[model samples]
Target: MCPPNCLHAVCEKATRRGLLKSGFTLGIAAMAGAGSLAGGARPASAATDTGPLSFSKITDMSHTLYEGFPTFSGERWFEMERPVTWEKDRVNLNRWTLMEHTGTHIDAPLHFSEDGNSVDLIPVADLLCPLAIIDIRAKAAADADAYLTPDDIAAWEAQHGEIPEGACVAMNSGWAAHLKTEKYTGLDAEGKNHTPGFHHEAARFLIEERSVRGIAVDTLSLDRGLASGEFPVHYDWLGSGRWGVECIASMDEIAPSGAYVFVGAPKVAGGSGGPSRIVALH
Candidate 1:
């Protein structure tokens, strides 16, 4: 009942959407960085404009119902059934008991710092902005404790141009591929995790130099889980009162660099960083 060309377009759109939500990337990867965001971020007050972004093909960077995946509680759990619901006296309610850091949740400043901003306190304007994806998968495959150094970002800039201020600096480490298994965590027998994260210098650049609105990643924490020496990344970003997006599951789907509208938010009341969705425009 549809035009032939339109049908093909629909099929392609469906495929892209599946690939995005399924957390599969068909491109190179990058690493996370520090952030001095939130001071003077450009506000994307309007998101209704259309462009080459293929909103129909938008991807959900949050985790799905996968068991043994990391959560804030330092444990792994996910939904087992489709309709996680309970009904009583015809009062049917739709509900899902997800962890605060489940899916694509933001890390409010309060998440780490003793006196940091909460999800509700974040300005609605800061939540949306252009996105920057930095790939560091190659380094990660070699060293588990590999961090995204400023030199790496500099190299990326040499090709992609200087990372514009107010852009959401994200990383693609290819770790999403291993999320289903323990190795994806890159945890060693010593119970220490060895994964790619923000390099101290890279963190400083994103925060003090480029002034990105926020830092996002497809990993457990902005800093590698194995970090214990000084914690430079956390010390810098949190000290600056910038938020972090953690446990993100995808990045390869987005354009290398472009104007994207961020739509992720929290529960407002009892939320630290709830599962949220993000979309990019060409």
Candidate 2:
């Protein structure tokens, strides 16, 4: 069920066909008036006096978790046990066992920083923010070890203007297409995974220059898989008191800019990280 006065409520009530046909525009002021509703501020492209902003589409950017889903450790991280069945117990119930960082998940600052915010300690406002997607699909396709570099950030800004303040910058390497295949993990004979991620410099640039709320990626880890044990990007980004999302699905569906992302991170006390239901509206 949608929360009272929440943006999900508006999405739930409006049919996609109806929204398209009527060219419905959601009022930013209305959303802001809802107190704790998502998208506390409007995008820079949208003027304060513009009255309303129209979002033509909504996309779910999270991947489903199952027993066999890929994990950084090359071991299964999710399992389900049916404890009760309707035919036998008159009700269906199941027990789930999973790791905190399984599937589409958020990496709270505490994941790396000793004195950082835990999953439950993260502020509500930071969970919802503007989305900036950096496309390195071509590069990643040719070189699995490719990472989002500072040049990529500059190129994206050259085309789409500067990344908005407090935005969630995501790297779209088109890696989600490899899910369910060994290619997704890209493990070699040495057991090192070859995947796309963010370069430390790019992560630092976003934090020091753009003041972004977080970073996200379509790959398993924030640093290039070849980085081995040195997680430079993770230490620099999360240790700096910022959050991140990993294994994000459908990043290709969202625009490079002008989209808002809602990261529904689990509020597990003292948790380093947890699975999240991430959605985008544009």
Worst 10 residues of 2 by lDDT: 35-44
By lDDT, who's the top model here? 2
lDDT of each: 0.64, 0.81
Residue 5 lDDT in model 1? 80
Which candidate should be chosen as best, given TM-score against the real structure? 2
What TM-score quantifies how close candidate 1 is to the native fold?
0.72
lDDT of 1: 0.64
Q: Write the per-residue lDDT of candidate 2 for residues 36-71, one digit (tens) a residue.
A: 211223322322334465677778999998888898
Positional deviation of 14 in candidate 2, in angstroms?
A: 2.8
Query: How many clashing residue pairs, candidate 1?
Result: 8
Output candidate 1 Cα RMSD: 8.2
Q: Residue 30 of model 1: what lDDT?
A: 13
